[model samples]
Target: MSRPRCERCLRAQDHCLCPLIPHLQSRTRVVVLQHPSERLHALNTARLATLGLVNAELRVGEVFADLDQLLATPGYRPVLLFPGEQAQALVGYAQEGCELPFMLIVPDGTWRKARKLLYLNPLLGELPRVTLGQVLPSRYRLRKAPEAGALSTLEAVVQGLNVLEAPGCFDQLLRPFEALIEGQIRAMGRETFERNHGGR
Candidate 1:
């Protein structure tokens, strides 16, 4: 029997959910700094962020070597997303009332690699860090992390936007993600059903 194709986008050639794309507008731009390794994975949620938000940008790199240049582009305020006792929280930027739009810099990788990226990039160290406080549970089942509250890229973006009271701006992006997961589950169930009933 031939391998079943992914049902979400119906791309036997590739897992492309391009048809289910959602376009959203936001006052806050999301900049996802995906680790080079995670870019190609079919399940990477950063891609969801890129597809969901009109203002979202996804840049894959091993480190933040060019982060300053990236941030210097027009209409972007880059903020590092990291949690630490010594780190100044996300609230600092809000209190300052900086007029520029904020860009949430999320490190997409294992905890260790994320830490390495933080340390290797001097520009990242200089930027104000924002740590989310809601502590929501993660929805990503395929990847495991030590922190139960650690969220996928899409979830983090949602939470961040909601915190800024711009939920409607990126709310559409959530639909495609839900559809993708649902499609995958339904496909698996169909395969199971067919296998069990095929000989009957």
Candidate 2:
């Protein structure tokens, strides 16, 4: 028989992280533009990130017809978190003390799919783009990143929130993410995981 699953976290009941994860609200709002295909990905952390925030929203689409309305939420400045040559690092801006509350738009998908979210949605492209400054190595040991400094969606959001708000945001926000990775490693066998992720 198939294991029971938690409809909310989408994790099997044995691995459900909901009870252990606490809800956190921030001054900034999270808006995830998730690819439809990533909805069921085992390692997807976008949902975890969204669940942590009180003023967060998750919208799935290749091109959002109502993106303009979403972006135009009064009293919040929409900022797209995408790194590239054209994007500005957020650390200095935070230090400079920009006063507007940000509506953070994060695209959840593969590199190619994330880029498509930017291109297909004209509104996303026009938003102010920001990136993390010198991210530490990702803690997602289960899946190798395509390149160095590539963080899971949850990591990026946590770091971004840290920049915009204060340090230590990562601690509360990463609890669920860390739990998911640990559960996966336990399922894979602790000895095998330790041999690879820890010194033998």
Candidate 2 colliding pairs: none
User: How many clashes in candidate 1?
Assistant: 0
Which regions of candidate 2 fall more than 4 Å away from where they truly are? 92-94, 194-200
- Model 1: what TM-score? 0.75
The parts of candidate 1 lying over 4 Å away from their true place are 1-15, 87-98, 141-145, 167-169, 187-200
Best by TM-score: 2
lDDT of 1 at 12: 44
Model 2: per-residue Cα lDDT over 1-200, one tens digit each = 98998988888887888886668878888999999899889976898888778878788779899888888899798989998778988773357687778899999999999998888987888888999987977889876678989999989988888877865365687888888888888788988887877722
Going through the candidates in the order shown, the clash numbers are 0, 0
- Model 2 compared with the native: what TM-score? 0.91
Alpha carbon lDDT of each predicted model: 0.68, 0.84
